[model samples]
Target: MRALLVEDNDRLAGLLVTGLRRAGWTADVVDSLDAAIAACRTHQFDAVLLDRGLPDGDGLDMLRALRDAAPPPAILVLTARGGLPERVEGLNRGADDYLVKPVALEELVARLNAAVRRMRGGRRGPILVGRLEYDPISRAVTIGGVPFDPPPRERLLLEHLLQAMPRPLGKEALEERLDSFERGIGSNAVEVYVHRLRRRMEDMRAGVSIETVRGVGYRLRAVD
Candidate 1:
């Protein structure tokens, strides 16, 4: 999942970004409300890790704006202020979840996943694409009821594409998302993973396919 992190503390933000990336998520960090708002305007995030206090203004102000976004991201507030009243106010304002400062990466990720699951109507099951199924929680892949384990990079590539199923993702965007997970990617890296994934799909005789759009990018499409 791709997220936007609204934090002012450099150390904390760096740690959050690293941990999030390690946990199979891509996040962009912003230190102020203005930057956060600008990011919200530009891109759609799966979630937002917001800090209550910021250099410019209270992060809730940005939250107010984001609440108006179409299909707004799940907002997870990470704040030092965790009084009951503060939590209530945040919730009333539109936060999906709230976390106190100095939180463990594990808990943060878990809560983020919970919020996303709630946003998705509590779906934590396999993602279906024709005859293929990809489970986000287990990082497991299955084709025609047969188990298949894709390499780490390959798995991440497929997961990313599947997350945006039915909609083609730009080649450059897909490459950026994959690079956030593993580095040293060559120019044809996306092609290589796609090719391997295709082979696996055929091996299982699955009805799923990743279609390449000549000038745009690739999309996960199910065949009849």
Candidate 2:
């Protein structure tokens, strides 16, 4: 798994990075909130290990910005503030998990994996259902283990839908997730992608189905 570690203490940061690597994960370490935000935008990470104290401001500031991100990565606050109020505040601010300092590497790794497991609904691998699988890492889809590459937008649309499994997603929500902040979406854009994706799935005889709820939104489901 890929991670972004935002901690100002040089020695601590190095230790954490080394520990993460030893645990079989690659991490990019940044010392400030600004660098953390920039790295987040430039790179896609499965989780972010955040320290509450930074030179510029509270790391919670970065947490707020990240919550607004599309498919926001999992966030785990690793700080020295162990007060009950502090833990409550961090979780309320959208942290997937929170850990106090002087934590063991084994416990940290376990907690991080637990956070991701909760986000993924206990699934550690791809979003799999019968013959179809959507791999989050590569943004790749396979049916009966056969590779299927949809158009870029359609591919992203599928990933978003699968991530939100068992929840019917509205058009407005899909548009916000797929479109860049500066890009204005056309009225029929979402419908077109949905329609195309549905047809592609049909033609492939895939073991998945996209269901449209009248006056509501679309949902992806595993079929028999």
Candidate 3:
């Protein structure tokens, strides 16, 4: 998935970008709040890793601005400020999740995934659709209680589709949701992922079908 990393510390920002990449995310690093706001306006990201302190202004303000937008990206605030009030204020201002400094990379990734999952209206954990269940945290999918393996990108694509089940999502819209702000994906990549995912579902006898809408895009329909 695509992400925005708003951090002023150059070293930490680099580390965060590399770590996010390893976790199947493309992240754009910005050191200032203005850049963060501009990036949010110009690009689409699945999530934003926001640091509360920035060079230009408070990251909380940026978070508030993002929340006020027509369609704000999911936000996970990263800060060294461990005060209870700060955490409470961040959540009250619409932050999806929060992580203090010195957090393990794995934990940060987990938090980001959870934030995105909730932003998509996913349940508390793995989402179940018909005979298939997908765990966003474990990055695992099971059909009929048997494990089904798919590539990471395909798994993420399936998660997105399953989250939007029964709703027809235009192809372009799907791409934007899957895209990270660091790199632009080709138009056909979404179709390619969907095609592969469809075959996998069929092979596993999963009672879920990805329906195509011709000029539109796709949707997941559960068959009981």
TM-score of each: 0.77, 0.56, 0.78
Candidate 3 residues lying further than 4 Å off, grouped into runs, are 21-26, 83-97, 113-130, 135-139, 222-224
Find the candidate with the highest TM-score and give its number.
3
Candidate-wise lDDT, in order: 0.82, 0.80, 0.82
- List pairs with backbone clashes in candidate 1: none
**Candidate 2 on 1-224: residue-level lDDT in tens?**
55789999999988997887665455668889998899778666668899998999889988888877676788999999999999999999989988999999989987776776666566557778657887764446898888988866677678778878888889887775555322446888999999999899888888788889788789998787
Model 2 Cα shift for residue 89 (angstroms):
0.7
The candidate maximizing lDDT is 1
- Tens-place lDDT per residue, model 1, 1-224, is 77889998999888888888777776788899988888788677778999988988888877778778887889999999999999999889889998988889999998898788788777676789888888876556788878877766677788888888778888787776665322446889999999999998887888888899889899988887
Off by over 4 Å in 2: 124-224
- Per-residue error (Å), model 1, residue 94: 0.6
- Summarize candidate 3's per-residue lDDT along 69-104 as a digit string, tens digits: 666788988999879999999898888988899999
Candidate 1 accuracy as TM-score: 0.77
lDDT-based ranking: 1, 3, 2
Best to worst by TM-score, what's the order? 3, 1, 2
